[model samples]
Each structure stands twice: as structure tokens, then as C-alpha cells.
Target: MLGASRMGAAPSASEEGEGEPPLTPSTCTFTRLVAKMAADKIVPVALELGGKSPMVVMGDADLKRAVAGAIAGMRFTRQGQSCTAASRIIVHRSLIDEFLAEMKAAVNAMVMGDPLDEATDIGTIISKQQFEKVKAYIKRGEADGGVAHSLSQVPTDPKLGEGYYVQPVIFTDLPSDSPVITEEIFGPVTALIPFDDYEEAVEIANSSEYGLGATIWTKDLKTAMNAVHRLEAGFVQVNQNLVVLPGLSYGGFKKSGIGKEASLEAMLDHFTHKKTIIINMT
Candidate 1:
């Protein structure tokens, strides 16, 4: 039997006790049943977990609009804290100066402090470990000859420091294989890679190990549509910001992740089996 687990209230005994509550008999039985069924499966099971996502902005894009959208895509939802954030941004070489200038201005304007504060635009990292990991990436960026620009000075509050907090960081002129460019920082860190032309932009975007999602910004409808067809990512956004629509299937190609989620069609594919039925009553 396939059992779908739902999030419920915490066990009362665990809340009252000093030590954690032991797994209940029912939960233990369910775990064993799942293991046994998996062990006896006739076919191999495959799980496509997660990865680092990249966002590419072409030379033809409007610098102001693209930079603003890129900032939102990178920093939205507290850096997504997920596998799908726009971790790397590839812009055309000609637009690099304008793009970076606008991006830096936009990022510098973000308010970072108390999450509960209505004016706060940025929030803390998930944990101390995560904060350290992100900081290490910042160091790596500097060491790799990538310029580091912080959105704001690190907060001075001791209480805030106790929690995981990192200022948004942007690394510019990053080499293709640099850690800042190649690996998933998984924090509020982004790298700006410059390409020469449209062909080069598409090449750089597709060069990554993860092909989760991509955004194309172009005034020419033909070029935008061509990019939509050529990109390796599962989810492609043209002349718009990255967002989830109820009607669109969301997933990635290669190492980004597996299967699809969100859309009703994707959900149906995940939850239902298809069979071909034939009738010979003629």
C-alpha cells in the first residue's frame, strides 16, 4: 500500500519530555512495510533529487529591467533556500557594465535586518552551518579573482549574529570553472558571467551541470522564441521574471532535478498510471 504522509501536530509526549519520543509502534510498522516493499520491487527505483540552477541574461535585454528582475530572482523568498534559485547569471559582455551597475545599486538598496520588521527586505540564513557555508563561498569568490560586492554591511547586533545572517553578495568577472561559477552556493550569492554574443550566451547557459530553469530577455520575439527552443532547461521563461504558474510544468533537465511538480498535468503524471485499452467487439 502506498501511504502519503501528512504533516501533523507534534507528539505530545515529545514536547513534555527532556529526551525525544521514541517512534510509535504504528510509525515503526509503517517504516518496515515501506522498506520491505522497496526491497521486493521488480524494477529499479530512481530518485532525481535537486541541484544548482542558473539564469542567463542576454545582451539584447534591457539592462534596467533585466538587472531588477535578476535581483528579484536571486534574492526572492530569502534566496529560495532551495535547489532552484538563480545562482549564476550570464550576461552579454557589452551589457556587463550597465547590468552590474544597476544590479549593485538595486542590491545595495535592499534592507537587511530583522525578518519581522516590515521594512526588512532580506532575512537570515537558515542556520549557523548554512551561514558558514555561504561565507566560505564568499571567500572562495575573492580567492578566485571574482570581485565581491555586498549589499550591506554585516549586521552589528549580537542577537542577529547568533542567528544565521548574510548580506547579499555578488561576484563579477567569474571564470567559467571557478567555484563561485561552477558550484551551488545555496545562499544569497550570485556570479556574473559575460558572453560575447547570442550564440555564446546560449552556450554559457547550457554549459552548467544543472539545467533546471532559464530566463531569456529580448525585445525581438523571434530571438526570444528561438532561445526558448534551444535552452536545455526544463522550465524556460522568456521576456519575463521567473515565477511559478499553476498551468506550467516545472522541473529540470540533466542534474537539476527529476520529474515535475506544481502544474496539474505534472501532478497527474506523478500520481496516475496510463494504460492502453483495446476493444475487439467489432
Candidate 2:
């Protein structure tokens, strides 16, 4: 029998954990370990797992501001290797062209170099295998009728040429239901699917199985408020995206995860237990 220590975390047995993922699985180890923890050990488990987050852009949204939010939300600096990356962009049909132009300029201006370098905007993919997987996804995105703007075009810098680095890519014109949009790529790739109205935008955003986070860009206060109520995600941002802090409980709805994280709720529920004591006054 694999002890809780072997799996590398025991919520009941351990001290307070800092805000970081306990495991970064290179294989099926995370899955196997989680199964053992929940099924066999029968202990408290709060899973903070995968996501395919969405960002919706209404026609009235400030393009420049929204584009900046999109870049920040994309996690391009981390090679888009984040669970909360809002990489699925559903833009207003009338604004797709303008959005694409701005996004291209934003991505082009980013500096991809050593992770430790202060000036570098982004770093390489985790490994050769992961790099190949991202490349394959880009190819599949094209096969699914999405037009790729930039396809893994590594920079000409001699220092960055030899490794698992890939440039950020944007795929436009794909259907809302395309696998590239539905699946979590976990790379610095985003898709642009156009919608005719706010209703369709919300519909498209809520269609994904994973609902970790979402962003809504609009100037209409009523529309933004409505979206805040309607969007099916644990974390919803209006007019901005991808802000994580200790005060906010981080987790996802549906298949994204099991419980809350990084807040008092998580600390009390998952990391601590409840006990009742009764005494008789004699």
C-alpha cells in the first residue's frame, strides 16, 4: 500500500502549505496520486486542477484595454502554462478584425528569452515532449478550420533558437465548438470565435466543460452585471482578467476541480476538521 507520504501530500498530517501547487505531474502521476488520496485514504481533498477559461469581448468594449487584458490573461510569460489562462477568446463578430490586429501587435512586442532574465517577456515550454504536444495542437487547430496567425515561429536569437521555445499563436475563424477551443491547450495559444450578440457570447462561453475562470469585456454596466451572474465559472472578471490574490478563493466549477483554494474557506474546510464537545453542568 502506498502511504500518504508516498503520494507527497496529506492534508490532515501536514503543516500549512504555501500557495503553490503540490504536484507538477510529468506523467499520469498526478491522476494516480489523487485517486489514491481520495479513494483509498478517504481523507479531505481540495483539488485545484485543469481549466479551459474563456474571455468574451462585446462590441462596446474598449479594444485597447481589452487587448491588454487578453495578453495579461493569456499567461504568455509563463508559456501559457497555467490552469487559469483565459485563452478562449469570443469576440464580437464586427470587432474580430480589429481585435486580431491589436493582439498581433501585442504578441509581436513581447520578448521571449531566458526565464531568469528580467527583460524577457516569456520563456520556453517545459520540455521537448510538451513542446511537441503544443505544436500538434496548433496543427490540429488548422485542421479544424481555424486560421493560424503565428505557428511556433521561434525567434532568430542564437541563444533561444535551440530548445522547446514556441512563439505565441492566435487562431481565428474556428467554430465555437472546435476542439481547439473546447480543449485546454495549456500553451500560449488563443482562439478567436466571433459572436453576433451578448446572448450568443454568453452561450459560447458557458459551453465549455471546464469552468475555472472567465472574463467579460463591455462598457454596458447592465450587460456586465448580467454576465457576472450568468457566466458559469468559479472566477469571473468584468472589464479585466486573471488576477489572483490570497483573499480570493481559487477553484473551478464542473470538471475543473473539487474544492476551493487559497482562502479562509479552504483553510477551515479542507485543512482543518470540526469537532463538537458537550459537557454537563453538575
Candidate 3:
């Protein structure tokens, strides 16, 4: 029961921050304005920020489902330009070889062309700046000793040459601390990393500075439920990727952002301002 929905209260979104100075480039500008608003005893904020989300593939997971989840979770279908994109693929060491082989084939086969075309798998980067940023991130991944597998099909029509079309890319064998592994690369790029055990897998996935969204792939209900408890992301889905169901709240934790999005909780929890008035009957 939010006052906003029932009583005409204003709606504002800001991150839950600790009284610290804004540091992340992604949220600093808006954070400053939020701080100014707070100084005036005005709006309180709940921030829903960017994510370096992860997809964990257990050894017992269905390889096809896990690989398909990987492809979808990376947001490559949208040029990987989603804040909640699960860009980190943390696979069980036993499944890395097969996972990468399947992923490589799947990624390569996607046809990149006009968004208007029904057959096009994905389309252009939003702008020249973002286009270069995506390319730079790929290069940085290479410099960090990560091998990139670029999607083979590029949109090459002379008519559509002006579009900012960059093929999607997948990087493998990256170190845990590699920028490509740790930073938020908001492009059609993902990195494949491996871990030895369930504990290590959770550790790798939770290592992200941004805990926006995460997905775990497996057949075991026990593992899925266990992972749901252990993963640090705000939204952890099992056997699926990037799912936003009706009335389910979605948001980030840690540096990914704050507050909830798309649910009753957003109004009643984050955006609500409770007030009470009392008067004498005299």
C-alpha cells in the first residue's frame, strides 16, 4: 500500500547508498543530482544500477539448456546492451570444453542484419561512442589474455553501412580479475570462466562488483535451491536466463544499483513515504 498509488504520492527512484561519495561512472552523475535533492530534504532515492551478472553451468546441467541460456543471458539478441546481461559464464571445469564448443557454434550461426528482417538474430550498437566502447572492451579482453570468438555474420549491406553494426563476441580463458571479467561491458560480449566446485562456482559468480542478476543452470532441484540461497545477485533464476515475470520485482544489489523495479514492492517498499496525522475531536 504505497501512498503514491492510492494517495497521489510522487514517485522517485534512487539507489540505497551508504553515505559515501559516488564512485562508479555509470551512476555518479545521477547520484550527484540525487544528493542535491536530499540536501533539500526532498526526495529519497533507490538506485537500480548496472550489472556484471553471471550464468553458472553445473557439471550435471543439461548442456543444451545451459548453452542456450548462456546465449540468451548475454543479451546478444539485443546487441548485449542490457544492464542486466549475464556477461560472465562461469562453467564447471568438467563442462567448459563442451560448453565452449557448443556456444561457439551457436554464437557464430546467428544472422546479424536489419532489425526489420525476421531472420536477423541481432542488430546495431546504439551509437559510434558505444560502438567504439564495445570494440575497446573486446581488445581489452584480448590484452588480458582472453581469447575472443567473434560472431561470423556481420551486417554488410552497403545500404545499411552507416549503422553501428559490430558482431557479437565471446571471450574465454580469462583470469578472475580481468577487466573483461570484472567490469561492466554493456555490449554483445561475454567471457567464459571455469571453476572447480559448487563453492568455487558461487564464489566466482559473487565476485562481481555488480550483483544485479544471475542464473544457475541444472536439473537438480537441490542444487538450484541451494544456489538460490548462496548467489549474491538480487534476482537469481534457475535453469533460465533474464526472466522478468509479471508482478515479480527486479533490481540490483551491491554496485549494480539499489531498490526494486516492476512490482508492488517498488511502491510499498522503496518509493513509499509514510505519514500520519492526528487531530483532537474537541
The C-alpha TM-scores of every prediction are 0.80, 0.85, 0.86
**Which regions in candidate 2 have their CA more than 4 angstroms from the true location?**
1-33, 151-153
User: Where does model 1 exceed 4 Å of error?
Assistant: 1-48, 279-282
Over 4 Å off, model 3: 1-33, 277-282
lDDT for each residue of candidate 3 in 1-282, tens digit (9 for 90 to 100):
111011111121122133221122444445555657876996667767667888999999999998888888887889988877878999999999999899889988888888888988888887665666566667767877888888757766898888888888888877787767777767898888888899999998988777888989888999999999989989989999967888998777777666887899888986777889999999
- Top TM-score prediction, candidate number: 3
In model 2, which range of ten residues has the least summed lDDT?
Answer: 4-13
Query: Per TM-score, what order, best first?
Result: 3, 2, 1
Clashing pairs in 2: none
Q: Residues 15-39, candidate 1, lDDT per residue (tens digit)?
A: 4353322121222234355456767
Cα deviation of 212, candidate 2, in Å:
0.5
lDDT of 2 at 232: 92
